[model samples]
Target: MYEADQPGHGLDAIVAQRTPRGGAAQHGISKKYAMHHRSGPSLWLWHMRRGDFDAAWTVSDVVLEARRGTACPHLPRHEQWVWDGTPLAGRRVLVRCYHGLGDTLQFIRYAPLVKAVAREVIVWAQPKLIPLLRTVRGIDRLMPLHDGAPDAEYDVDVELMELPHVFRTTLRDLPREVPYIHAKPLAAFTSPIKRRYGRLHVGIAWRSGDWDARRSIPFALMARIAEIPGIVLHILQFGSGLEELPDGFGVLHDVSDISKMAAVVRALDLVVTVDSMPAHLAGALGTPVWTLLHMEPDWRWMAGREDSPWYPTMRLFRQERQGEWGPVVERVSVELIRLLSREAPQCASGRSGD
Candidate 1:
């Protein structure tokens, strides 16, 4: 047992609060199965949430060793378990992305590292992401993931999420370098932002995917942010909640294309977003980002922390109370005002005698 994985590392409190006995039943999962699996991946998540990467990696080692020789499960490609703890050196490796877009964007940083050891690295990813990913290094081939079978052949396969375990990544070893995913500003997407000069151009995305409703902030609440002076707000949210956007809240944008969204994010001075794809995109591009989170966020944001080790440019604002976003919004507004105030003097000096 690693020192971080030992009893005093906050696991007891996390498991007790996060995984009550009946919690699985509330999600339509069997209590028996959930209990059985809780000690493995679930434990890993708890450790990760506490920023105990050493413990999480310890759990991962147990998992990989236990299931090393098992055959791939009979299930859909996205649900299928690949990567049976095989070493990647000198082999053609297929890295399948069987998770959300944000997950892929975060973990794909490992590709270049993987390529350092493997003979060839082929990324089977979401079709929409292939264009943006072309900007990344160490990929010999990029293929779209689909319902049909993949045409590329490989000696071994691994899930994108498993790369951290493969590398025995620690908090210190976790990738913090940015612009790993790069793109130029698309004129169509960035025209509104470029037109507004000498103002803080801030982009916002308040909605997350439907898997967790707690992650999404009410768009109407964003009016407080829009009221801040000397800052131009651009709405980078795409998908279901656009109708909730109050009139003239910000410049509405078509962020349906991931690559174009990257370009627009690159053009912005700062990005303020919920825990969504846009947040990952901004962080990946080396753009300064402020991520708002609910009381208990995903493991990536971790607990009791205001900064992310994964992306150095990212700052986190977390809720003190569950489902209460007013305080969080107020703090963000206050900080934005302070940011603008600091930059105002610099702007005035540059415009002097004009």
Candidate 2:
């Protein structure tokens, strides 16, 4: 039932019986049994049933074995295989990822990197991410979750997160280019906001949903920032924090959609935010951004670099110690004052070093 023209390519019937698994599942048993079928290097498709404990455990074991030189690479390690780029070149490849927007964003950077070395890179991602990913640079094609075996079109398949370690990436060697999302057409500011906030608009996001305890900045800290003169702090965040916004904190605009968020971000002179998607988006747009990272930050932020290689216009402000926004906020406050006081320079003129 598979052909080159059909979605399944050729192994559609075989994949029909295989159930797909989600992240953190095990697949050692499947790999152990599938080893007997090798003929001119046949491809073994391992399907992980979502939330299946046994399956998750088996897959984890399979991955462990592959890393230890026992079994071949499977889901989760698939991206690593692609990055290694030797075994799967000139062959069809199937790639899968855990289901989440952030997970997708963190790993999708490898798609183009994979495409650089592999003949074909068919990605299996959560349905919600498909629209956002359409604008991403490197994917050859995409299949929604639970799509049957990748057909005869794939000579190999692997999971998404494994790409980095497989490529033996250290903090110094991360693929640091901006790769996840592209700049969307930004809407011009409406006459009212333009007149009310004036030309220099700054966007701020103080909290990230995933890292609430560690990532949230004290409201009082943001309040100190608002107190800075000649600058407007526009609240671009949505959800629960809106209720607690301090009085006289300038305008609070509800940005519920990605496109609208992009537009408002485009209109800003700068974005000062905690580590969140908005910071990433602003960096991607080459907008001037000051990103505040926690003491023990995400690996991507790395360590000891004020400037991000991925976003040229982005600057990093790390906490000197854990759970203290006081010093960081104070530093930002001082920097903002300096930026405000300086006379506007001609276009293309570089500002003095920070």
Candidate 3:
């Protein structure tokens, strides 16, 4: 088993204190599962209360099993568990996820899969994700998580990350295809951006600070790509980076709403982004995208592949070496230039081409 010295005694105490009504025997499984750190104590408590010890224990076993296999390195071993032996048939199931659009996008792929097995599948997502996740397949309803607990009740509830393993996913078994999220057009607003940059809009996102600094591309590299002619780069970054556009880069600053951003992405000719939400959004919209990836990227991107199974229109550009954004950026730049150059004739003739 992938046993590491239990690092947080405080957290262990928290789990012990929150032990469900099943008493210490069941709590023992909770404690062992908690050692995996795939979820929080509250989630464990929620599972125990629902009598999902079998599901919870399955999560624990899967983590231990994976750690002993070769796939352990690429897998997010810290983020999975088996379902307690509960038959999901006829049960109302709700899926939960913490914040982070990339994570939601990755796991939401399984929502439809889950719905296939369960009578109902309600996705409880962070508020920020609700707008986007509402469009995903297999979700009967979108429930916003509040106060770290599911706002709605269900017969069985599982964390969103746990769905893949519950379904026994391997690279070969993954649900790979694009446009899984079917978001409806809310309302159209005339973009001053269109007037300013003349058709052929492209969105750019370069950083996600919380996901490890190494996954982020340098601002300088993004600036170079923005300098490419004939393509308009709209900035879709959240928080401080929205105001941190590098010199000579044209960014649409007025986009504050995610729905509007989704519209803008849909209207774009292409999207070039780091491994972030914009990439997932673009994929969901069936928009053509070129995603920049770090060498040791999240498992959804998998390893050593130029195409993503989840998004048909999305292409990937990976770092041949770790922490090297320059090569990836340069390759993207060249590819963009070539793509545009090839399409220049089509543009001259007033025709659209890929």
Clashes of 2: 23
Q: What is candidate 2's lDDT per residue for 177-251, written digit by digit as tens?
A: 653565443434433444543234578888766324587686768778877766777787665466668676766
User: What is candidate 1's lDDT per residue for 297-332, written digit by digit as tens?
Assistant: 777788888999999889999999999989999999
Which of the predicted structures, 1 or 3, would earn the higher lDDT when compared with the native? 1
Name the 10 consecutive residues with the lowest summed lDDT in model 2. 1-10
Superposed by TM-score, candidate 2 places the C-alpha of residue 343 at a distance from the truth, in angstroms, of: 7.0
Identify the leading candidate in terms of lDDT: 1
Cα displacement (angstroms), candidate 1, residue 154, comes to 0.6
lDDT score, residue 313, model 1? 87
TM-score of 1: 0.84
Model 3 clash count equals: 11
Off by over 4 Å in 3: 1-82, 170-173, 184-200, 246-248, 344-354
Q: Write the per-residue lDDT of candidate 3 for residues 73-167, one digit (tens) a residue.
A: 23232333223435566789977664355557656888878888899988867666677777777889897766445567788766666565467
